[model samples]
Target: MVVVKGQDTSEPGGVPAHPAASASADAGDEAAEDDRRPSPDDLHELLAERGLAPDDVDQMVDVAAVGITARWWRNTKVEDWHAGSAIGALSDVDMYRINTHTTAKVRERLRRWRREQGLHTMVDVADADPAPLNRVFYNLYRWFTNPNRTLIIGTTLRDVVAQTLSNARTHPDCDVPDNVTTETELEDYDNQVAGAAGYLLESMDEYDPRSVLYSPALFATVWARRWWGLPDYPSHVDRVFAVLADPGHRTWQNRPIPPPPDGVNLVDVRKKMLTKPWELPDSVCQWLINDAAEHYIFD
Candidate 1:
């Protein structure tokens, strides 16, 4: 939550304020603040000084960065979510003060940083099988809900998990495992989800699926899609179209969608869906932001 120093910080009606609204309101102040904030490269150098990498920052922050990946819209409504998530991610480092990498940039950093640590991306997972995805989530759910496990249920991660489970359980093709088959079963696990965004690998063995699946691309996309009321399985055109066609499913109010930026092809991008935006050109970052703001979620 973005707390203004002199304003009422209480969440009116208990509904979290929209990122765009908060961001737009604070744009002038944030621009001044950003001047004092470390650049992404500076942040990386600081992390290296303290023997940490981007991955050590925490998943929630990463997702938030991905949500507003491009610096193109900094100091705008787009920057609001980024500011909160980045600050939260930096809090985990105990040394560094901030992070500003997009999902693509973060993934690139991971590909390089993790390689130095002898970790590589999973290349053979031909399909994003929800069974494994659910299993990974199920374990994370267990960990998050466990009182013995000292974990802080940060806002971003809590929102991500809640949204992910909702997507997994509702997507027509999803075959949710019996263990986590019902909303009540999991809802009973924990009542209040709050705290600084974070993750703990201590209890997770080397072979744990989260080692590969607990990713912004893999896990956080659910939360990202939730912005536009999109469900899991981006490849599922039928479901995606169904959701798009239904006025009721548009969680946010309907708005005028502007023409996409030149040289940007939404169809081509969708065809290559889940291609890991960072792996492509930097423009993919721009394309995603354009799609989200002008075409999909906001206008």
Candidate 2:
């Protein structure tokens, strides 16, 4: 799938459709990674089995509005005036390094981060946690037309949940739902992303008949995550990650996907990540916290 610049609407045919990633581009090369990630189909089946779907937004306007709302929720605190950071960084204990974090560790940590931080929504997220995710959301959310940050796991639901919980937790008065289990179901990073893919599949398929809840534009966001950067980009990360970290998007860069280490166990990996104790710039980390104050009127 080729991403076209300035074409933000993810309506039908808004973006180019390459064959689904489950299929491969190169027939002869085993090295060529055929979007081995689970297809939306497989995920939809899982969601259906679990009985879930999108709320069904009314129109493209509605899609963009909800999308924008979610992003706005994330970015309410990009500036440093309210942030307590002397130079705009979270304290040493609060800083969570994206790299060096094992996939195994990220998943459990992501969920736990949410539970401890209280980040179900923006208000809750900012009121308490105040991490960098909000800033990135604000910077990248181009009226939700740009799926730069708002996919199932990559940006939309998962990003909000993960960022809120992980950055520093979100709400204080808001208690985690009694039904919401703090247990760790999926531990692997790939598995977390995979579960998101599955949820998106179910959401899109069911909402196709009569709603704006899950529009085609979302697929574009998904496409971008799978997007292969040109040869010029870094080897480990794709272009999107690079773009977020680019000079222009510095405030939005936040944490990285963590470095990939071969043959590392979870316990050992967490030990290593904790040792570094680094996050994105301090200014970026506090955006969520500040924004939450404004939105949720956090005390």
Candidate 3:
């Protein structure tokens, strides 16, 4: 795919004198004025004269072709793979552009997709059942291959928290809560929430089985806020955990209905409940109820 330019090695009559002809003045003079052009071999010699060895020229051509092939494959094959699903209907050219996208561009697109899918944090993936988890894996896999995919996959609670914070940072309209502007502040908040969630999940034996089952809804409410672009204040975060820690303190309801906070759009929440209530796991439902109760108490 690489073309190398040849240097002109013509003499006065556009002919090159043969080596043997140079032994005699008369033969050299006759060959010099022959007016014949150089052959392929003569061109090679001319290129060599310019310091480009045959082997070096071959290597350069090969390297250039390889680089072109690699770019084409990355921008073609990967793009088609993503187009296989209804949700991923990007054109070949669009996918190619995405393949070559800068980090900020990729993150912006990823944030939009997350918003559309209502996926706020890595915890959503971590706590997902097999079906949801597989969907998440497939979505991520379509964009990138193995080692790079690892960058988005979270294996631990801490990793999930870190990923959640990272996503928040990428969101253009993100409204970080007070005390959570810097990396250190965000990490501290992550630790607090993770510790609380872990303690609640682990302390299930201490609470009534019915209440413990209901506790998942409490966590779900917190997760839901993330989907709605609402900030998770420390007080509310601690309160959700506290309620989970003491499930027996309050009666468990079949459904916990939380009033939408001021400025929070209820359209998506309402739509999900009306059309896809099953998507709201029991934990999320409980959190909704507790959220309503807390709102009432504060009011």
Clashes of each: 3, 22, 8
* Cα lDDT listed for each candidate: 0.32, 0.28, 0.31
Name model 2 segments beyond 4 Å from true: 1-187, 207-292
lDDT of 1: 0.32
**Candidate 2 on 7-126: residue-level lDDT in tens?**
332211111122222211222232233234333344334323433332211222222222222212211221111122332222322422221122223223333544666555423422
Better of 2 and 3 by lDDT: 3
Task: Give the lDDT ranking, best first.
Answer: 1, 3, 2
Query: What does each candidate score in C-alpha RMSD?
Result: 20.7, 21.2, 32.1
How far residue 153's Cα lies from its native spot in candidate 1, in Å, is 28
Reference-based TM-score, model 1: 0.27
The worst-scoring run of ten residues by lDDT in candidate 2 lies at 73-82
Residues forming the 10-long window of minimal summed lDDT in candidate 3: 11-20
Which stretches of model 1 miss by more than 4 angstroms?
1-3, 7-81, 84-199, 205-231, 236-256, 279-299
lDDT of 1 by residue, 1-299 (tens): 23334544432110012221222223223323332323234333443453334344343234433432211112222122233332222121210111122334434543443344343322222122324433433444354444343222233323433444455455453433556522432243242111101111211232232223232222234224432212223434334434444556553356533344578666665554444322334454444444333124321
Instruction: Kindly provide the TM-score of model 2 when superposed on the true structure, using C-alpha atoms.
Output: 0.19
What TM-scores do the predictions have?
0.27, 0.19, 0.18
Q: Candidate 3, residues 46-99: lDDT per residue as tens digits?
A: 434533332232222222122121222222222222332222223333322232
